[model samples]
Target chain A: MDTDLARERILDAAEDLFYARGIQAVGMDAVRDAAGVTLRRMYQLFPSKGDLVEAYLARRDARWLDSLATHVDTVGPTAQARVLAVFDWLEDWFARPDFHGCAFINSFGELAGTSPQVTAAARHHKDAFHAYLHQLTTAAGATAATGAQIALLAEGAMTTAAISGTPAPARHAKAAALNLLTLDARPVASPA
Target chain B: MDTDLARERILDAAEDLFYARGIQAVGMDAVRDAAGVTLRRMYQLFPSKGDLVEAYLARRDARWLDSLATHVDTVGPTAQARVLAVFDWLEDWFARPDFHGCAFINSFGELAGTSPQVTAAARHHKDAFHAYLHQLTTAAGATAATGAQIALLAEGAMTTAAISGTPAPARHAKAAALNLLTLDARPVASPA
Candidate 1:
């Protein structure tokens, strides 16, 4: 197998297995078998399980963010609409049969206590996500704080939707975000 | 050892171990060792690992909800204050040294895919929590939809605070909850 192709195949299997069945539950041998790569080739591509896990998360982080941003760019027309569009994107995601939850949140919950690499990866993913929301809210003439609050609604919707097995939280969160935007954009009155 | 005490000890240890390390990473042997019970006693009490996990989550659900209610009742003098008190309770929880996020969220992330018991337990916990918030919001003269939106803020705060290792999300969530309450309670003007 070509080295790059073998690497991608390995990561693809690893991501699917890890996301579906928690990280500790899936072994490197399972990943090799699923990827159709020999143990020797798998080891060569990722020397250790830790290295493989890190690569899986790093790739996922990039891919997930890119997908969200692309959707936002495609559908969101104005600053406020862009913010609400995130929840629309989330509703679609939550409705998918394969949707579990936020990979970063799930990964952190499953491994952050024992794995610092996992902790850093989860933190970095969220920081980047929060920053993206802040930029959107800033463009909408809202405070950074409002941006953080909006981000909370999005985060909440993901977990809630995943656990409840419904996409309704996304709608609730979008409504809340709209209300926050309206309230935050209100002009402060000068003393009479 | 008394059966009831042994069960409690086992659950206490299991909860700590499972929360500190992911559930799959901590075996029944580790739980027995941590609880200082014999293998025979442990098996006699829990029957299986699944049973132990269920018991841990069940006890946690009751206790966690009770803790939130107790705090809310003590600090919240009015309906609006009661609703915001939920966030304050979350802030204190996030600040705890051993805080690892919502147990149900973590457990669902770790085991819900494979364990029906875990899936049900997670769903039940979240349902009960959302219902409690709905009750509070209704008392505060907000619509059920507004109640759900506020619940999303609390849910988001838990996940964010866990990943970021900061209690600040609780404050952000509290502020957002306040805004939601205000917006939700506004009386619609009759046609003039």
Candidate 2:
């Protein structure tokens, strides 16, 4: 296989195996087998399991945000609807038969303590997701803080759906996001 | 040591070790050393690692919610304030030096796919948490569904804080929850 093709194949296998099974549970050999790439080729491409894991996450992060953005663009020309589109996308994702929750969330939980690379990847992914929400919220006539709030709801929905095995949390969060976006938030100062 | 005392010591060790290190990273021998209990005694008290994990979660669940409930009761006599109080507890928990994240969340992520016990334990904890929020939300003049929304914020705050290594998500979630509690939710019908 071409180097590029080999690299993509390696990552495709890693994302599937690492996501479905926690990181520590999968061996590098398993990834090689799943990718149908030789050990020498795999190491030549990734150098280390950590490197492969990092690449896996970086690739997933870009693709995840891209998918969300695509969905948002399709569902929204309006900023408010764009924000709602996120949860709609989440609802759809949660319903996928292969859905196992946010890969970043799962990867971080599995590897944060043992791997700095994994931790940084998860943090960066969330920060980018937060920034995306900021843009959407500001466009919807809410402050950046409002976007941060919506980001929390989105994260919560992901975890809740993952654990509860239902997509309902997405809609629940969507309802709350809608309220926060449209409502007068000034008089509602939280005790925090 | 007596069975009751031995059990307590084992749990303390498991909670401390598991929370600091992911569960998969900590072994039975580590738990033994940390707790100062002999290996034989440990197995006698908890037959398997799964049992110990279940005990850790079951105990932690009761204690964690209890601590939050106690703090909420002490700080907020009013119904609406009680709802915000949940976030207050989260902020405090997040600020702790050893704070990792929600035990149930971490445990679920670490073992849910491989262990039915872990999955069931996590689901039950969340259900209980949702119910607790339901009581607080309804008391605060919000519907049970509103409580469910707030539950998502709380869950989001926990994961966001854990990943970002900051307590800010708790306050952000709190602000969102406050808006959700007081807002006219009807006009904010979600696109989903």
Candidate 3:
């Protein structure tokens, strides 16, 4: 196989195994077998397990954010709606049959102590997520601090849903976010 | 050592290792060495790594809730203050030199997929946490749903602090929870 296709295949396997089983529990050989790639090809493509883990996280981050943004664009008609849409999006994600949790959060828990690369990857992913929420909040005339608070609700929903095996947290967080927006984003009177 | 003393020592070592590092990364022998217990004695107490993990989570759950309640008892004079005090407790916890994150959250992420015991333990911990917040909210005249939402903020702060490596999320969550309390728990007018 060509190098690009081979790399994609290997990463696909890695994402599945690592996310499902925890990163440390899955071996490179397992990834190789699942990807249908030879060990030599896997090494040539990833060079090391660390490299593979980083690539998996990078790809997953992009795809996860892109999917969320795409959903928001489709259903959200106003700035306020856009903010709430994040929780709606989360509810859908939590309902997925194969959903485990936030991969970055899981990876951070599993590897952040021993792996700087994983730590950096997890931080970068969260930073991007927070930045995106900040943009939505800014457009809605909410402070960046409000944006940060909303992000916490989203973060909380992910872990809550993951642990309870339920999507109800998304709805609960949405109500809280709505209450926040109602109070924080109200229009101030114009000066005469 | 007596059986109870040996069990306590083993759990202390297990909690340290499991919290600092991930669960799967640490082995029975490592826990044995850290606890200064012989292998046979270790097995005599825990019998399996699963037993050790469940014990660690169960003990951590009790102590964690006890600590939070104790802090609230000492510093929180009003119902409103008691609710906000949960965040103050979290901020202190996030600043601890040995703090990693919520042990249940980390354990669920690492082992929930493959271990039913860990899954049940995680769910129980969260349920009890939510119930505790419900008590505070009930005392403060808020709905049960509001209690769940507050719990989400606390949950969010945990993962956010763990990933960002900062205690700032605690303060942010506190601000949001305060706003929630101000809106949701207001006084009602008396009928004439």
Best candidate (score: TM-score): 1
Which structure among the candidates has the greatest DockQ? 1
Model 2 lDDT tens row, B59-161: 9999988998899999757888888989988998999888887888877777776888988998999999989999988888887778889999999999999
What TM-score do all the candidates reach, one by one?
A: 0.96, 0.94, 0.95
Summarize candidate 3's per-residue lDDT along B1-192 as a digit string, tens digits.
899899888999998999998898899999989999898999988878888888899999999999999999996569989999999999999999888888888888888778899989999999999999999988988888888889999999999999999999999999999888766654222322
- TM-score, cand. 1: 0.96
Clashing pairs in 1: none
The Cα local distance difference test for each model comes to: 0.91, 0.88, 0.90
Q: What is the DockQ of each candidate?
A: 0.62, 0.50, 0.53
Per-residue lDDT tens digits for candidate 3, residues A80-183, read 99989999999999999899999999989888778899999999999999999999988888888889999999999999999999999999999998887766
- Candidate 3 chain A weakest ten by summed lDDT: A183-192
Off by over 4 Å in 1: A187-192, B187-192
> How badly does each model clash, as a count of residue pairs?
0, 0, 0
Native-structure RMSD, model 2? 3.4
Report the Cα lDDT for residue B1, model 1. Answer: 82
RMSD over all Cα atoms, model 1: 2.4
Interface RMSD score of each model: 2.3, 3.2, 3.2
DockQ of 1: 0.62
List of clashing residue pairs for candidate 3: none
TM-score of chain A of 2: 0.94
Off by over 4 Å in 3: A187-192, B187-192
